[model samples]
Target: MSIYEKIGGEAAVDAAVDIFYRKVLADDRINEFFDTVDMESQHTKQKAFLTMAFGGPNSYTGKDMREAHKNMKLTEDHFNAVAENLVATLQDLNVGQEEIDAIIAVCLTVKDDVLNV
Candidate 1:
Protein backbone atom coordinates (compact mmCIF):
# COMPACT_ATOMS: atom_id res chain seq x y z
CA MET A 1 0.00 0.00 0.00
CA SER A 2 1.02 3.60 -0.54
CA ILE A 3 2.14 5.70 2.41
CA TYR A 4 -1.14 7.52 2.21
CA GLU A 5 -3.00 4.24 2.50
CA LYS A 6 -0.70 3.21 5.30
CA ILE A 7 -1.54 6.36 7.21
CA GLY A 8 -5.29 5.81 6.76
CA GLY A 9 -5.71 7.73 3.50
CA GLU A 10 -8.01 10.70 2.94
CA ALA A 11 -9.64 10.67 6.34
CA ALA A 12 -6.27 10.86 8.05
CA VAL A 13 -5.07 13.61 5.75
CA ASP A 14 -8.22 15.57 6.47
CA ALA A 15 -7.75 15.32 10.20
CA ALA A 16 -4.07 16.25 9.97
CA VAL A 17 -4.80 19.34 7.92
CA ASP A 18 -7.51 20.42 10.33
CA ILE A 19 -5.30 20.00 13.35
CA PHE A 20 -2.28 21.39 11.55
CA TYR A 21 -3.98 24.63 10.60
CA ARG A 22 -5.41 25.11 14.05
CA LYS A 23 -1.92 24.98 15.50
CA VAL A 24 -0.58 27.19 12.73
CA LEU A 25 -3.17 29.87 13.26
CA ALA A 26 -2.45 29.89 16.94
CA ASP A 27 1.28 30.12 16.40
CA ASP A 28 2.60 33.63 16.75
CA ARG A 29 5.54 32.79 14.54
CA ILE A 30 3.35 32.17 11.51
CA ASN A 31 -0.15 33.37 12.31
CA GLU A 32 0.52 36.81 10.87
CA PHE A 33 1.02 35.34 7.42
CA PHE A 34 -2.48 33.88 7.51
CA ASP A 35 -4.30 36.88 8.92
CA THR A 36 -5.68 37.89 5.54
CA VAL A 37 -6.28 34.34 4.36
CA ASP A 38 -9.66 32.69 4.11
CA MET A 39 -8.87 29.72 6.34
CA GLU A 40 -11.91 27.65 5.36
CA SER A 41 -10.84 27.75 1.75
CA GLN A 42 -7.23 27.25 2.72
CA HIS A 43 -8.21 24.23 4.75
CA THR A 44 -9.88 22.66 1.74
CA LYS A 45 -6.85 23.38 -0.44
CA GLN A 46 -4.47 21.91 2.11
CA LYS A 47 -6.51 18.75 2.28
CA ALA A 48 -6.16 18.32 -1.45
CA PHE A 49 -2.47 19.27 -1.50
CA LEU A 50 -1.55 16.85 1.26
CA THR A 51 -3.73 14.14 -0.22
CA MET A 52 -1.63 14.23 -3.36
CA ALA A 53 1.64 14.65 -1.50
CA PHE A 54 0.94 11.57 0.56
CA GLY A 55 0.28 9.57 -2.64
CA GLY A 56 -3.44 9.32 -2.30
CA PRO A 57 -4.49 10.97 -5.61
CA ASN A 58 -3.32 13.68 -7.98
CA SER A 59 -6.28 15.90 -7.25
CA TYR A 60 -4.77 19.13 -6.01
CA THR A 61 -6.03 21.99 -8.16
CA GLY A 62 -4.25 24.86 -6.47
CA LYS A 63 -1.35 26.95 -7.68
CA ASP A 64 2.07 25.37 -7.87
CA MET A 65 4.23 25.82 -4.79
CA ARG A 66 6.63 28.36 -6.23
CA GLU A 67 3.88 30.43 -7.78
CA ALA A 68 1.75 30.20 -4.68
CA HIS A 69 4.44 31.35 -2.31
CA LYS A 70 6.28 33.68 -4.63
CA ASN A 71 6.95 37.19 -3.37
CA MET A 72 5.82 36.11 0.09
CA LYS A 73 9.38 36.67 1.46
CA LEU A 74 9.28 33.39 3.30
CA THR A 75 12.29 32.72 5.47
CA GLU A 76 13.76 29.51 6.79
CA ASP A 77 12.35 30.30 10.22
CA HIS A 78 8.85 30.45 8.79
CA PHE A 79 9.43 27.22 6.95
CA ASN A 80 10.71 25.53 10.10
CA ALA A 81 7.70 26.75 12.04
CA VAL A 82 5.38 25.23 9.48
CA ALA A 83 7.33 21.99 9.56
CA GLU A 84 7.15 21.89 13.29
CA ASN A 85 3.40 22.44 13.16
CA LEU A 86 3.02 19.53 10.77
CA VAL A 87 5.12 17.23 12.94
CA ALA A 88 3.26 18.20 16.08
CA THR A 89 -0.07 17.71 14.38
CA LEU A 90 0.82 14.21 13.19
CA GLN A 91 2.24 13.31 16.56
CA ASP A 92 -0.90 14.52 18.28
CA LEU A 93 -2.94 12.31 15.97
CA ASN A 94 -0.85 9.31 17.06
CA VAL A 95 0.80 8.82 13.69
CA GLY A 96 3.89 6.65 14.02
CA GLN A 97 7.41 8.09 13.77
CA GLU A 98 8.28 6.15 10.65
CA GLU A 99 5.28 7.50 8.80
CA ILE A 100 5.97 10.99 10.05
CA ASP A 101 9.57 10.69 8.88
CA ALA A 102 8.45 9.65 5.43
CA ILE A 103 5.96 12.48 5.28
CA ILE A 104 8.59 14.97 6.37
CA ALA A 105 10.95 13.72 3.72
CA VAL A 106 8.36 14.38 1.06
CA CYS A 107 7.71 17.79 2.51
CA LEU A 108 11.40 18.63 2.60
CA THR A 109 11.64 18.00 -1.11
CA VAL A 110 9.25 20.90 -1.65
CA LYS A 111 11.04 23.33 0.61
CA ASP A 112 12.94 25.08 -2.15
CA ASP A 113 9.80 25.47 -4.21
CA VAL A 114 7.71 26.70 -1.34
CA LEU A 115 10.41 29.11 -0.31
CA ASN A 116 10.83 30.33 -3.89
CA VAL A 117 14.53 29.72 -3.57
Candidate 2:
Protein backbone atom coordinates (compact mmCIF):
# COMPACT_ATOMS: atom_id res chain seq x y z
CA MET A 1 0.00 0.00 0.00
CA SER A 2 1.02 3.59 -0.56
CA ILE A 3 2.47 5.45 2.40
CA TYR A 4 -0.51 7.75 2.21
CA GLU A 5 -2.94 4.92 2.69
CA LYS A 6 -0.74 3.31 5.27
CA ILE A 7 -0.74 6.50 7.28
CA GLY A 8 -4.45 7.34 7.02
CA GLY A 9 -4.43 9.25 3.73
CA GLU A 10 -5.92 12.71 3.35
CA ALA A 11 -6.58 13.47 6.96
CA ALA A 12 -3.07 12.44 7.91
CA VAL A 13 -1.53 14.56 5.20
CA ASP A 14 -3.60 17.53 6.29
CA ALA A 15 -2.57 17.18 9.88
CA ALA A 16 1.08 16.72 9.06
CA VAL A 17 1.15 19.79 6.84
CA ASP A 18 -0.45 21.96 9.46
CA ILE A 19 1.85 20.78 12.21
CA PHE A 20 4.89 20.92 10.00
CA TYR A 21 4.24 24.50 9.04
CA ARG A 22 3.77 25.51 12.62
CA LYS A 23 7.14 24.00 13.46
CA VAL A 24 8.77 25.58 10.44
CA LEU A 25 7.43 28.98 11.28
CA ALA A 26 8.64 28.66 14.82
CA ASP A 27 12.05 27.47 13.74
CA ASP A 28 14.54 30.29 13.67
CA ARG A 29 16.85 28.24 11.52
CA ILE A 30 14.66 28.39 8.40
CA ASN A 31 11.76 30.64 9.19
CA GLU A 32 13.27 33.54 7.30
CA PHE A 33 12.64 31.76 4.02
CA PHE A 34 8.94 32.05 4.67
CA ASP A 35 8.91 35.62 5.90
CA THR A 36 6.95 36.99 2.94
CA VAL A 37 5.14 33.84 2.01
CA ASP A 38 1.39 33.58 1.97
CA MET A 39 1.22 30.72 4.46
CA GLU A 40 -2.36 29.72 3.68
CA SER A 41 -1.45 29.21 0.05
CA GLN A 42 1.76 27.53 1.05
CA HIS A 43 -0.10 25.14 3.28
CA THR A 44 -2.39 24.15 0.45
CA LYS A 45 0.51 23.63 -1.90
CA GLN A 46 2.37 21.58 0.71
CA LYS A 47 -0.62 19.32 1.25
CA ALA A 48 -0.84 18.64 -2.47
CA PHE A 49 2.90 18.13 -2.74
CA LEU A 50 3.09 15.71 0.17
CA THR A 51 0.05 13.81 -1.02
CA MET A 52 1.63 13.36 -4.41
CA ALA A 53 5.01 12.51 -2.89
CA PHE A 54 3.45 9.89 -0.67
CA GLY A 55 1.83 8.22 -3.68
CA GLY A 56 -1.65 9.32 -2.95
CA PRO A 57 -3.77 11.48 -5.29
CA ASN A 58 -1.62 13.55 -7.63
CA SER A 59 -3.35 16.91 -7.79
CA TYR A 60 -0.04 18.72 -7.44
CA THR A 61 0.83 21.02 -10.31
CA GLY A 62 3.37 23.23 -8.64
CA LYS A 63 6.78 24.09 -10.01
CA ASP A 64 9.48 21.50 -9.96
CA MET A 65 11.69 21.54 -6.85
CA ARG A 66 14.53 23.32 -8.63
CA GLU A 67 12.38 26.09 -9.97
CA ALA A 68 10.33 26.36 -6.83
CA HIS A 69 13.33 26.93 -4.54
CA LYS A 70 15.92 28.21 -6.99
CA ASN A 71 16.00 31.74 -5.68
CA MET A 72 16.13 30.72 -2.03
CA LYS A 73 19.82 29.82 -1.98
CA LEU A 74 19.11 26.89 0.26
CA THR A 75 22.06 25.05 1.75
CA GLU A 76 22.54 21.63 3.23
CA ASP A 77 21.90 23.05 6.69
CA HIS A 78 18.61 24.53 5.58
CA PHE A 79 17.63 21.28 3.98
CA ASN A 80 18.56 19.38 7.11
CA ALA A 81 16.55 21.77 9.21
CA VAL A 82 13.48 21.16 7.13
CA ALA A 83 14.07 17.44 7.23
CA GLU A 84 14.38 17.56 10.96
CA ASN A 85 11.11 19.41 11.24
CA LEU A 86 9.43 16.89 8.96
CA VAL A 87 10.70 14.00 11.04
CA ALA A 88 9.48 15.72 14.15
CA THR A 89 6.10 16.27 12.60
CA LEU A 90 5.74 12.65 11.65
CA GLN A 91 6.89 11.52 15.06
CA ASP A 92 4.41 13.87 16.69
CA LEU A 93 1.64 12.21 14.73
CA ASN A 94 2.78 8.78 15.94
CA VAL A 95 3.80 7.58 12.51
CA GLY A 96 6.05 4.55 12.65
CA GLN A 97 9.81 4.83 12.18
CA GLU A 98 9.73 2.83 8.98
CA GLU A 99 7.13 5.10 7.43
CA ILE A 100 9.00 8.21 8.54
CA ASP A 101 12.18 6.86 7.04
CA ALA A 102 10.33 6.08 3.82
CA ILE A 103 8.83 9.54 3.71
CA ILE A 104 12.23 11.14 4.25
CA ALA A 105 13.74 8.99 1.56
CA VAL A 106 11.26 10.45 -0.87
CA CYS A 107 12.10 13.96 0.31
CA LEU A 108 15.80 13.27 -0.14
CA THR A 109 15.22 12.50 -3.81
CA VAL A 110 14.57 16.22 -4.34
CA LYS A 111 17.37 17.50 -2.14
CA ASP A 112 19.70 18.46 -4.94
CA ASP A 113 16.87 20.05 -6.84
CA VAL A 114 15.73 22.05 -3.84
CA LEU A 115 19.27 23.21 -3.23
CA ASN A 116 19.63 23.96 -6.96
CA VAL A 117 22.95 22.18 -7.01
Candidate 3:
Protein backbone atom coordinates (compact mmCIF):
# COMPACT_ATOMS: atom_id res chain seq x y z
CA MET A 1 0.00 0.00 0.00
CA SER A 2 1.05 3.58 -0.53
CA ILE A 3 2.32 5.42 2.50
CA TYR A 4 -0.87 7.45 2.55
CA GLU A 5 -2.98 4.36 2.71
CA LYS A 6 -0.70 2.93 5.33
CA ILE A 7 -1.03 6.01 7.51
CA GLY A 8 -4.83 6.11 7.15
CA GLY A 9 -5.62 9.03 4.81
CA GLU A 10 -6.75 12.66 4.68
CA ALA A 11 -8.39 12.49 8.07
CA ALA A 12 -5.22 11.21 9.64
CA VAL A 13 -3.11 13.78 7.84
CA ASP A 14 -5.40 16.55 9.00
CA ALA A 15 -5.27 15.36 12.59
CA ALA A 16 -1.50 15.07 12.59
CA VAL A 17 -1.08 18.53 11.10
CA ASP A 18 -3.49 20.15 13.54
CA ILE A 19 -1.58 18.76 16.46
CA PHE A 20 1.79 19.52 14.93
CA TYR A 21 1.02 23.15 14.17
CA ARG A 22 -0.45 23.80 17.59
CA LYS A 23 2.87 22.78 19.08
CA VAL A 24 4.86 24.69 16.50
CA LEU A 25 2.91 27.88 17.06
CA ALA A 26 3.45 27.67 20.78
CA ASP A 27 7.12 26.86 20.44
CA ASP A 28 9.30 29.91 20.92
CA ARG A 29 12.04 28.73 18.62
CA ILE A 30 9.73 28.09 15.65
CA ASN A 31 6.90 30.47 16.43
CA GLU A 32 8.74 33.37 14.84
CA PHE A 33 8.57 31.68 11.45
CA PHE A 34 4.82 31.45 11.70
CA ASP A 35 4.02 34.75 13.41
CA THR A 36 2.85 36.47 10.26
CA VAL A 37 1.37 33.42 8.61
CA ASP A 38 -2.33 32.72 8.48
CA MET A 39 -2.53 29.62 10.63
CA GLU A 40 -5.29 27.97 8.64
CA SER A 41 -3.63 28.57 5.33
CA GLN A 42 -0.28 27.47 6.60
CA HIS A 43 -1.83 24.38 8.06
CA THR A 44 -3.48 23.60 4.78
CA LYS A 45 -0.20 23.95 2.94
CA GLN A 46 1.55 21.73 5.43
CA LYS A 47 -1.14 19.13 5.04
CA ALA A 48 -0.70 19.21 1.32
CA PHE A 49 3.03 18.87 1.65
CA LEU A 50 2.87 15.99 4.06
CA THR A 51 0.14 14.23 2.17
CA MET A 52 2.03 14.40 -1.08
CA ALA A 53 5.25 13.39 0.57
CA PHE A 54 3.62 10.32 2.03
CA GLY A 55 2.16 9.06 -1.25
CA GLY A 56 -1.30 10.54 -0.94
CA PRO A 57 -3.41 11.68 -3.87
CA ASN A 58 -2.84 15.40 -3.36
CA SER A 59 -0.20 17.23 -5.28
CA TYR A 60 2.02 19.46 -3.16
CA THR A 61 3.04 21.87 -5.90
CA GLY A 62 4.35 24.36 -3.37
CA LYS A 63 7.61 26.26 -3.53
CA ASP A 64 10.55 24.01 -2.95
CA MET A 65 11.08 23.40 0.75
CA ARG A 66 14.64 24.64 0.57
CA GLU A 67 13.57 27.93 -1.00
CA ALA A 68 10.62 28.35 1.30
CA HIS A 69 12.88 27.85 4.32
CA LYS A 70 16.03 29.43 2.96
CA ASN A 71 15.63 32.72 4.75
CA MET A 72 15.09 30.95 8.04
CA LYS A 73 18.58 29.44 7.96
CA LEU A 74 17.24 26.16 9.28
CA THR A 75 19.75 23.98 11.03
CA GLU A 76 20.03 20.55 12.64
CA ASP A 77 18.71 22.03 15.87
CA HIS A 78 15.57 23.30 14.18
CA PHE A 79 15.11 20.03 12.30
CA ASN A 80 15.47 18.03 15.48
CA ALA A 81 12.86 20.14 17.19
CA VAL A 82 10.46 19.58 14.36
CA ALA A 83 11.17 15.86 14.37
CA GLU A 84 10.51 15.68 18.08
CA ASN A 85 7.27 17.54 17.67
CA LEU A 86 6.25 15.13 14.92
CA VAL A 87 7.01 12.10 17.03
CA ALA A 88 5.00 13.49 19.91
CA THR A 89 2.07 14.33 17.68
CA LEU A 90 2.10 10.86 16.15
CA GLN A 91 2.11 9.27 19.57
CA ASP A 92 -0.69 11.51 20.77
CA LEU A 93 -2.73 10.50 17.76
CA ASN A 94 -2.02 6.82 18.43
CA VAL A 95 -0.22 6.20 15.18
CA GLY A 96 1.69 2.91 15.11
CA GLN A 97 5.45 2.80 15.23
CA GLU A 98 5.68 1.27 11.76
CA GLU A 99 3.51 3.97 10.29
CA ILE A 100 5.35 6.65 12.19
CA ASP A 101 8.63 5.33 10.96
CA ALA A 102 7.39 5.45 7.39
CA ILE A 103 6.32 9.05 7.85
CA ILE A 104 9.60 9.94 9.51
CA ALA A 105 11.50 8.30 6.71
CA VAL A 106 9.75 10.58 4.27
CA CYS A 107 10.74 13.55 6.40
CA LEU A 108 14.32 12.36 6.60
CA THR A 109 14.43 12.00 2.84
CA VAL A 110 13.78 15.71 2.61
CA LYS A 111 16.24 16.91 5.19
CA ASP A 112 18.20 18.73 2.54
CA ASP A 113 15.00 20.34 1.39
CA VAL A 114 14.37 21.96 4.75
CA LEU A 115 17.80 22.52 6.22
CA ASN A 116 20.93 24.43 5.37
CA VAL A 117 23.01 22.92 8.13
- By summed lDDT, the worst window of 10 consecutive residues in model 1 runs over 54-63
**Which tens-of-lDDT digit does each residue in 10-107 have in candidate 1?**
88998888888899999999999899988889888778767766778874433488888899999999999998998899899898899888888878
**What shift in Å separates residue 85 of candidate 3 from its native position after superposition?**
0.9
Give the alpha-carbon lDDT of every model: 0.84, 0.86, 0.79
lDDT by residue (tens digit), candidate 3, 27-102 = 8877788889888888987787768656789644324776777778787878878878888888998878887788
Error of 2 at 8 (Å): 0.4
What lDDT does candidate 1 reach at residue 77? 96
- How well does candidate 1 score on lDDT at residue 31? 92
Error at 41, model 2, angstroms? 0.9
Candidate 2 versus truth, CA RMSD in Å, comes to 1.7
What's the residue-level lDDT of 23 in candidate 1? Answer: 94
How much is 104 displaced in model 1, in angstroms? Answer: 0.3
**Residue pairs with clashing backbones, model 3:** none
State the lDDT of candidate 2 residue by residue for 8-108, as single tens digits: 99999988899988999999999998999998898987787678666688743324777888778899999999999989998999999999889888888
What lDDT does candidate 2 reach at residue 25? Answer: 93
- How much does each candidate deviate from the true structure in C-alpha RMSD? 1.9, 1.7, 2.1
